[model samples]
Target: MPNARSVVVFDAFGTLFDVHSAVARNAASIGPASVHLSEIWRAKQLEYTWTLSLMGRYEPFWRLTERALDQALARSPEVDPVVRDTLLTSYRALDAYPEVPGTLARLKARGARTAILSNGDEAMLADAVASAGIGGAFDAVLSVDRVRVFKTDPRTYALVEQEFGCGREDVLFVSSNRWDVAGAVAFGFEAAWVNRAGVPDEYADLAAAMVVGTLDAIR
Candidate 1:
């Protein structure tokens, strides 16, 4: 396996940015009691992604986000329409995780190239990077729009290798999602699970090369 010298391709949502905050903001629009709605919605969204991935029926992340949000709202009658729309707007501008800047800086200082490989469309990612004031933090920002499939698919994972012009083993795939870490490992990339929630044992069978509480740990 290639070491840290290899390019690091990170998953955007949950790994580098906070998608939950956006969901919460939107859920609040419907009703005052929707505090935990965003979290539940996020979990369901990820579950849907995994389910679709296994079923071989792939859809764009944006579509999934909208679908997940709609379903989540359907279950809760108090969500307001105006608030929901505003929350959707907030999603396009999610703040970066607190550790993202320092961790990314450390990697860059070490001469390690960094990039984002996400299910987010290029437009959404561009806005997010700009909003987070870290557009330059990444060497490349990859998207799944070209392939129309989510992560774990060979086409989506292959972008890292293609962009950096490196072999699969020469890239270190980092993600907060266990399925993503597993997929990277399966694809021959040195995988690291950013166990931000301390869920190392949850994905233990995937054999992630490394597990860390923060990106700084890996850097």
Candidate 2:
């Protein structure tokens, strides 16, 4: 029997998939530049999203990601046209964290419905999920595209309640991103923080229900 709160909603990207996998996978071409590229690329990508959102300028996450990549590798001597294409291609098939499939399966066996509420566009989510071989694991994959907004938007978080027809408290919203955890909690969901990097809780005031290091510790 499932608990009263039987729905688990995950934040995709860095939570389930390693956002740096593409760079690491193409390391031969990218060289030692992968480390700096990953950090700057991720930061710039997120900054672009928020910047666009604040300006009411809407663009697909894919577009923002490509632009961020251009900026990240713009001055790097290591990246060539071919390496750039390879890194972009690798992004389509990101590596899933080792425990993701098992954790999802365990939740499913317990009669819980699992889903992904991601800032990723539908196409990106589909490609990554399919590549990770965890496509069938989710009952639904909710992309911000449907609402046409990024996370931290109340509308994005509302998708979970909308899909499950349950109150916020009945959906255990899990995210590895601190901002995302705070956003879900602020939106009234029973949010949990997957502090996988062992960082201190920056949003401790958000009152998250759980502050564990991984999805497997969601309870």
Candidate 3:
């Protein structure tokens, strides 16, 4: 069970925010390829992070996001160049999940320290948070940019302890991404896998403390 002193850290993209909404918003311009484009863009974005990490190289997540978009667009040449610009702009202000504000409010009401720990760069996180109008909901919005690396990295997870001065056990790390939950579990933090899509599970050896279909089910 969580307590007032427990820090409830959340993954921003896909967890609290809807990363695919950018493409959804531009569906009229993207035609039948919108879903595929969004899927490829996200997969490549994550791939770049892991690949760059292993190569001991670093780039801002925003750059990787744009590059991923380029690849997605390359496979979708039917989309106008103007639409690509619009999609990129839309991504910076992706919509928050409907339950996010309420869930964060409920957690804060109980005196839990809430925060967003994301692989996004600081500016990207800032734009998304502000656009969602949930800027005041978090005690902090931590970005992997500080360490110049991405998730599944020990240093990336260490930001939580460094910010809250709490032990791993006292933190409940929540992410919609199963791999991220696995990484948190491996780092010794109690984690919740927000399996929002009801997808099949992986990383069976790194089980989450809890698995829920939505953020509201966390408590």
Name the 10 consecutive residues with the lowest summed lDDT in model 3.
1-10
Model 1 score (lDDT):
0.80
> For candidate 1, lDDT tens digit of each residue in 1-219?
335755888999988888877865554345565765686678777877778877878777777887787777777676654555677788888878888899889889988889999988888889889999988989999998877777778788998888889888678888988888888888888888888778536556668888888877767
For candidate 2, which ten residues in a row score worst on lDDT?
A: 1-10
Give the TM-scores of the predictions, in the order they appear: 0.88, 0.94, 0.97
Clashes found in each candidate (C-alpha, N, C closer than 3 A): 4, 0, 0
TM-score ranking of the models: 3, 2, 1
Please write out the lDDT profile of model 3 over residues 1-219, one tens digit for every residue.
444337999999999999999999989877888899999999999999999988989899999999999988887787765777898899999999889889988998888998899999999999999999999999999999999889999999999999988898889999999999999999999898999788998999999878898989765
Q: Please report how far candidate 3 places residue 70 from its true position, in Å.
A: 0.4
Best candidate, TM-score-wise? 3
Full-model lDDT for every candidate:
0.80, 0.86, 0.91
Q: What ranking of all candidate models by lDDT puts the best one first?
A: 3, 2, 1
Q: For residue 29, give model 1's deviation from the true position in Å.
A: 5.5
lDDT of 3: 0.91
